[model samples]
Target: MAVINNDSSVFQRIPNELANSIFDFLPNRDIKNLRLICRYLDRHVPLRFNRVFISANPLDVKVFLAIANHDTFRKQVKELIWDATLQSPRSCGNDSDDDYGSDEDSSDDNDYQGQSRFQRGCREAIEDAESRLVDKADGNEQQSLLDNLMTSGRALSYYERLVEEQADVLETRADEEAV
Candidate 1:
């Protein structure tokens, strides 16, 4: 049997329709790894890892802000997952002035109730501190801080705007096809 050597590249020989069909069957992690194999794959693989989880924790907020500011990454993002659970520091159970109950008469149930109340208080304190920091910040910083606070609604709005923009692009492409 004679060896067949096609002048065209393997990827070029495969139709984009077939490539997309194959890509659909692959898991997201595999797809991401496949994208690194060649420029064509890199460009053709639509963003499957689209969800961006943003928690109330400061570090996660920082990451969310970074993604929001990035033009290309932000457009690829489809969902903004918000986790609003407050992350409080572990208490030592020492008799500090901030302690909710006196150590003398605190039973197990009362201790649990007190801890719950303390957690709520901690959450409120964090919000108050953040507000104070925002107030002290200069014009741009203040705006950024406010944006971080409103990120849940703002992220949704941003995603909606992106969808609208994509729709417009599709419409323009369709018009070109018609012509």
Candidate 2:
């Protein structure tokens, strides 16, 4: 025997407007998670993520291409913005130490001229901290500060690689090709 239902399921019964309103209030992450949880919700709440960002980063361009190529996501893209700013050739200020830091040593130029402004600042700060440590810190505090500064320096190096990659991308007009 076949059973006939007079009433439809709650999801099929819900209005699109109400679903849109609910989705509008939810964050992007939440919307994605919600869709994954319930197929009914996924089908009912069509993604309204209309805006996207593109930058010098390779992953950024790759993702943009993926979206543009996609049948559904392509329709949602409303804007394609280019991030022009690139972190190229860090300036080691030779003009005045006052601009970089007030430390007395900064006033006297030396081999440290090769260091970036931020690197100089970190070095000055660490030196100042070491002096304050007095007898309490022999090499222990200095080593800790050195470790932290080294980590920061490593991060800066990674960023520099990205900057170089961005410059290459623009030179080859890879962005135009992707489009």
Candidate 3:
């Protein structure tokens, strides 16, 4: 026999606003699932889902050019952050000796030049990306760029977390060393 209650409503009933709020914080994969639930619910999410992230990948010029040419998803991108792992060869500024640091002032000039060159290269890259934005390029190019962007972005965030952890570890080690 089937059991029936006259005062029954819904077992899993949640307020729409509350549900949307909860769903917003869910992972991207879960969000995809949530979107499949209903079109009304999917409309609540922002457009950021369409844009991709590529943070730390060592990208070649061609790969960079490709991402700038994507069609449907490209227009949704508000900003693109390229974290090229370009660093100066000299860490002499971090040296403890003041006199030695002062003596190596010329090295600072070299570092400045290196930095300017790097900045120029980045500017050129941005220009190139912008130029490719309107072209009817190969769809594969955009996909490759999207992959690189996601991979790089993930790697950068991972490294940032690792650096924070390392800092904490160093502090603990220093305390132990001092003791």
lDDT of 2 by residue, 1-179 (tens): 22223235455566878867777898878877766666676766666547776776677789888888889888977877777666665564563454664444454322243446656655667668757666674568665655445443665677678878888877877776777
Give residue 22's lDDT in candidate 2 (0 to 100): 73
Which of 1 and 3 is the better model by TM-score?
1
Give the per-residue Cα lDDT of candidate 2 at 154.
68
Q: What are the runs in model 3 whose C-alpha is more than 4 Å off? A: 1-13, 47-51, 54-79, 83-179
Ranking by TM-score: 2, 1, 3
Clashing pairs in 2: none
Cα lDDT tens digits, model 3, 59-155, are 2333434555756445666665544343233243533432222322443111222233233343345447646665645665754563344332344
Which segments of model 2 are wrong by more than 4 Å? 1-21, 24-29, 36-46, 91-115, 120-150
Candidate with better lDDT, 1 vs 3? 1
Give candidate 2's TM-score.
Answer: 0.55
After aligning candidate 3 to the native by TM-score, how far in Å is the CA of 120 from where it should be? 38
Better of 1 and 2 by lDDT: 2
Q: What does the lDDT read for residue 67 in candidate 2?
A: 87
Q: Estimate each model's TM-score.
A: 0.37, 0.55, 0.23
State residue 167's C-alpha deviation in candidate 2, in Å.
2.0
